[model samples]
Target: MDTDVIICGAGAAGLTLAVDLARRHIRFLLIDKAAGPFAGSRGKGIQPRSQEVFEDLGVIDAIVASGGEYPVQRHYTEDGTTVDEPVVVRSEPTAAEPYRIPLLVPQFLTERRLRERLTELGHIPRYGRELTGFAQDADGVTAEIAGPGGEQTVRARYLIGADGGSSTVRKALGIGFPGRTLGVRAVVADVLAEGVTADAWHRWGDGTAAQVSLCPLYGTEMFQLQGPLPFDVEVDLSAAGLTALVRERTGRDDLAIHAVSWASAFEMNARLADTYRQGRVFLAGDAAHCHPPTGGQGLNTGVQDAYNLGWKLAGVLGGAPDALLDSYEAERRPIAEDVLGLSTRLLEAARNRDHRRGREVGQLDLGYPDSPLSLASPGHDKGVRPGDRAPDAPVTGAGGLPTRLFTLFRGPHWTLLGHGVDRASAPAPRTGLRVHTIGARGDILDPGSHVRDGYGLASGRWVLVRPDGYVAAVLDTAGLPAAEAFLDSVGVRPPL
Candidate 1:
C-alpha cells in the first residue's frame, strides 16, 4: 500500500490525526479541499483535555502562546446600558487538573499551528486535494482525488473522513447523519469595526427581537460577528449588507463596521453519524458528528475524536489486534452522542437566557468507562479508574528532575505508574512500554505524595496508562496481571 492511513480534510480533526500519526512514524497522507488554511476565528475554545492532548503532541506551547483567555461577554440593553458586570469564572490549575480554564485561539490559527507542527514532522497537508470517491475491501481502501495536478488514485490501508458536516466519505459509506437543525439561523462574519471595546464580548438586542454579538478575536484586528437572521428570510451576505444588519440589529449606527474580512451563515444543527467506522473506512470530527457551537464542543470534540482514534490506528497498524480498531467507534461514538446532547441543551439554555458554563464546558470529565478497553480490578477506588483520564501530578524523576505525570506520559508509549509499589520487582522496559515508580524504593520520586494522593494510590498499587493517556487498568499488583490481559486483548505484548 502507498500509506497506512489516508486522512481527508485538513481541519482540526484531520490535522490532529496527521500530527499523531506522523509522530508515531505511521505513514499517512493528509488532504483538504480548501485552497489554503482556513481563515475564520470560528471554534475558538480549546478545552483543558484538548490542551493536555496538545501538550502530548508537543504543540501546547504554540497553541497557548497564539491565543488568549476568553473574555466575559457583556450584554447591553436597548438603551445602550450595560446589562450586568461581566465576571469570568476561572478554575486554578492544580496538580491533578493542570489546565483548569479554556483557551481562546481562533480555529484558523489553531489549524495553522497544527499544520506547522506537522510540517516540522516532515508531512504537509495537500491543499486543494479533494477525495471524489472511494472503495474498500478486506485488503485496503482506494480513493480517487481531484488535485491541482489532475485526477489521481491513492491506496491506503484505511481511509478517514474529517471533511465536515456534509462528509463525502460518510455519505459514500452510507452512514446516516440523523438529526434536526435549529430552524433559526445566525449570520456570522469576521469584520473590522470601530467604537467597540476589545476587553469584553459585546452584545446587543434581546432574544425577542434580533441579537448581535461582536467578540474580539485574540491576536487579530478582526471580530467575529454573530447576529440573528430572520426565521423565514434570506439576507444578503455582503460587506454593505453585514454593516446594515449590524446597525439594524444593534440599533447602534454610531458603531460602524469598517470592513468585512470573511463571512458565513450559521444554521445550527445537532447530528451524529449512525456509526463512526465501517470496514476500512472511518469518520471523525464534523464528518462523524456535528453540533451547535454553544458549549464550544464542535472543534474540541472533533479533536478528541482524532486523539482517541489516532493511537488506536497506530496501535493496530503496528501489529496490535484489529479488534483494537473496534474500540475507536465504541469509545468515541458514545462520547459524541453525550456531547451532542450537551451542546443542544446549551443552545436551548442560551436561547432562553440561561447562559452560564462551568466545569462541564471544559470537557475534563469526558471519559470512556464503558469502553471495552477499560478493565478495572476489584477493591481499588477513590480517584481515577480504568477508562478515566490519567490525571497529572507533580513528581521527581531521575537525576532529581522535577516532573509531572503528563511529562512521563508525553511520548508514544504505554506508562506503568507504580505508586508505593516495590520496584525491586518492576517489569523491565519493552517495546511500547515505560515503567516508573513513585514512593516505593524510588525509581521515580514523589516528594509531596502528589502522585500517590492524586491517584488514591496505596501500597502495592499500580496503574497502566494507555498510549493515548487514558487509564487502562489499576490494581495492587506490581506484576500487572490485569494490564497484561488488557494488553493481550489488544495484541500488544509487553515483556513481563
Candidate 2:
C-alpha cells in the first residue's frame, strides 16, 4: 500500500484527521481541491466539546488565541428601532469544564491553526488535488486523483471523505445523501466595510421578515454578511450585487462595502448520508452529515467526527480486528442524526424570531451513551458514565506543579485514570496508554478532591478513557479484569 489512509479534503475535518494521523506516526495523504485553505468565516463557533478535542490534538492554544467570544447581536426594525441581545448565553467555567462559552473564530483561522499543527508534525496537505473517483476492494482502495500536474492513481488501506456536503467520494460510492432543503435562502459574504460597529453583530430586519446581518469576524478586519434571498430569485454573488443588497436592506447610504473578499449562496440544508462507511472507505464531517447553520453545529460536529475516526483508523491500521472499524459509523452516525434534528429546530426557532441560543449549542453535553463501545459498570452508573466526555480536574504532578486531567490526556494516547488509588496499586504500563493514579499518595496528587468530585469515584474505582476523550468503561473494585477484557475486545495489544 502506498499509504495507510488517504483523506480527500483539507477543511476542518480533513485537517483535523491529518494532524491526528501525523501525531500517531501514521502514513497518510491529505489533499484539497482548492489551491489553498478556506478563506471565509463560514462556521465560526467553536463549541466547548470541540475545544477539548483541539486541546488533545495540540492546537487549542492557537485556536483560543485566534478566536474571541461571540458579540452581542443588535437587531434593527423597519422603523429604525434596535434591540440588543447576547449571541449565545454565556456559561461560567468550572474545574471540570474549562471551556464553557463558545469561541467566535473564523473557519479559515481554525483551518490555519490545524494546518500549522499538521506542519509541526512534518506533514502538509497537497493542494490543487481533487479526488476524481476511486474503487475499493477487500484489502484496500485505489483512487483516481486529478491535480495541477495531471492525473495519478494512489492506493491506500482506507479512504476518508471529508470533502464537504456535496462529497465526491460519497457520490462515487453510491451512498444515499437523503434530506430536505429548508425554505431559508441567503447570500453570505466576507467583506471589508465601514459604518458598522465592530462590537455588535448588526441585523437589519427582524427575524419575521427578510434580514440582512453583518457579524464582525474575530482576528480579521472583515465582517460576514448574511442577506436573505428570495426563493425564486437567482442569487447575484458578484461584489456589486452583494453591496447593492446590503445598501438596499440596511437603508444606510453611509455604510460602504470597500471590498468583497469571499461570497457564496447559503441554503440551509439538513442532510445525512445513508451510511458513514462503505467497505474500505469512510465518511466524516459534512460528508456524513449536513446541518443548518443556526446552532453553529456544522463545523464543530465535523471536527469531532474526524477526532472520533482518527484513533480508530490508527488502531485498525496497527493490526486490530477489521470489525473494530465498524464502530466508527455506528457511533458517529447517530450523533449526526441528533445534531440534524437540533440544528433544524434551531433554524425554525430563528425563523420565529426566537434568537435565544442556550448552552445546548455549546455541544458539551453530547455523548455516546448507547454506543456499543460504552460499557457501564452495573451499579457505578452515577457521575461520568461510559460514552461520556471525560471531565478534567486539577491535579499536582511531580515537583508539586499544577496540572489538569486534560494535560494527562493531551497527547495521542488512551488515559487510564485511577481515582483515589495509590501509586503501588496502579495498572501496569501498556502501549499507547498512560496510567495516572490520582489520590493523596498517588502518582499525581488531587488534593482539591476535584477528581473525586468530577469522576465520582472512590478509592477502589477507576475509569478508562478512550483516545478520543470519551469514557470507555467505568470500573468498580474488580475493575482490572473487566477493563482488560474491554481492552482486549477493542484489540488493545500488549507492548512489544
RMSD of 1: 1.6
| Residue-level lDDT for 24 in candidate 2 | 93
Leading candidate by lDDT: 2
Candidate 2 local lDDT, residue 267: 76
TM-score for each candidate, following the candidate numbering: 0.97, 0.97
- Residue clash pairs of candidate 1: none
| Model 1 stretches with alpha carbons more than 4 Å out | 84-88, 494-496
Q: What overall lDDT goes with each candidate model?
A: 0.85, 0.87
For 1-496, candidate 2 gives per-residue lDDT tens digits of: 3888999999999999999999999999999898988988899989999998998898898999997998999988778888899988877999999999899999999999999999999999999999988888899999988999899999999999999998999999899999999988877888988889899999876574457888999899999998668777787777677767778888888887888888888777899999999999999999889898888999999999999999989888887778878889888898889889999999888877777789888888889888888876776847899998899888899568999989888877888888766567655666877888776667788888898888888677889999988998888647677787677766575777
